[model samples]
Target: MKRTDIYPMPEFFERYINLTDDVELKDAFAISLQELKQLPLDKWEAIGDKVYAPDKWTIKDILQHMIDTERILTYRALCIARGENARLPAFDEESYARHTDASNRTLEDLIDELSLVRASSLAMFNSFTEEMLQRSGLSFRGSYSVLALGFIVTGHQRWHLNIIKERYEVLG
Candidate 1:
């Protein structure tokens, strides 16, 4: 499936869509996994609780957010692909960051969990048929397709990784 297959693009998601270059869903997923695997975990650990600015997320917080958001997007894709019509609610990232115990966990641990999560996501997405990939559903922001959600998952990670490179000085 291609990004063009996603109908009624959610306005808020345009940035993420633009960040992605791959038009094919499988290629997009593979690129996302490759980029994630190349993250400089050592540099992230070296930074250690450092936030680029006041009231900003720490490196650990960003990593945790990536994992959390990936899981949420994957779930949304699954639901949409299954033809669920429920309108999903929005999540408060700041609130989630504050409440999460990511600070207690090592970067290595988070990365490992992220790998597992991505693997599960791959398995689920790999099972989707073309019709399933084109399925759409209501969300807090707007309508989204299973294919778009898949791309969003990848692009969202790319967006965060760019921030990490620019703000946190973590080499990609």
Candidate 2:
């Protein structure tokens, strides 16, 4: 799915769409990667503790949501990078949200989980060669270049960060 937005979802990642194959999307990924890694526990917890606006999610919920997204999108990216040609299965985000209790878990734990997944994802991406970046494959959304699939990691993260910062944090 191609979604454009006003902030990071669109702007921060705008550089990726024009980038030709063989360039590391990791440089783009690195923009927010470290800062996201270093976000204080207090900040992460604050998102959890604040009461969100009507119909929005708590900071904890947002973090939990991002954690879930990282798992899904990275797997998709990896599958494409690894030469998978079949269509990936779709998952229901709303159903998963109801099954997990973001409220019960500490914000620190959620942050830790994000850190772990991101670390794994970074390692996975770093291991890919320029040839791998040029690989072609299909995902649940249909066919895409391996290079384009790689950009989804940071693009998706930046997408949610925009929501969290502007809506979840501000409105909370």
Candidate 3:
């Protein structure tokens, strides 16, 4: 499904969804993955745990956050597509980051986890039929379609990539 098919877009997810192009959800994932794999890892490694601002997440932390969010979004899509009616619980990203051991992990390790999680997400979304893709479910913010979740996953990745480039990359 195309990004434009997402009707009555949930307010909270607008920023992430808007960052993506109005393309097929599968292609959005591919484009984002290609962009991710093309990042200058050597330069990013030089930045290490440095944060552009105080209390901001380091590169590794950001990578871990990406993996975590993708998994959550993918699971939400799965549950929604299966006709789940329960309002999914919202997660506290800051709390997850605070409890994470991303600080002790290498950038490579975090990136690997993110890549694996994204691959799983890609496979899962690709399995959904057009009708399943249109399935919507209630969340903490509001209702969201399976198609929107797929785009949000990719778009959220791009959002962080932009921050890393504009903010963190300069630190190198």
Best model number under TM-score: 3
The TM-score values for the models, in the order shown, are 0.92, 0.75, 0.96
lDDT of 1 by residue, 76-135 (tens): 998888889889778888988989999999988887887788778878988999999888
lDDT of 2 by residue, 41-141 (tens): 65555555565556566777777877887788778767877878788777787787777889898877887887787778778777887777666665554
Candidate 3 residue lDDT tens string, 73-107: 99899999999999998899999999999989887
User: Alpha carbon lDDT of residue 74, candidate 2?
Assistant: 73
Q: By TM-score, how accurate is candidate 2?
A: 0.75
- Can you list the residue pairs that collide in candidate 3? none
Order of all candidates by TM-score, from best down to worst? 3, 1, 2
For model 3, the superposed segments whose C-alpha errors exceed 4 Å read: none
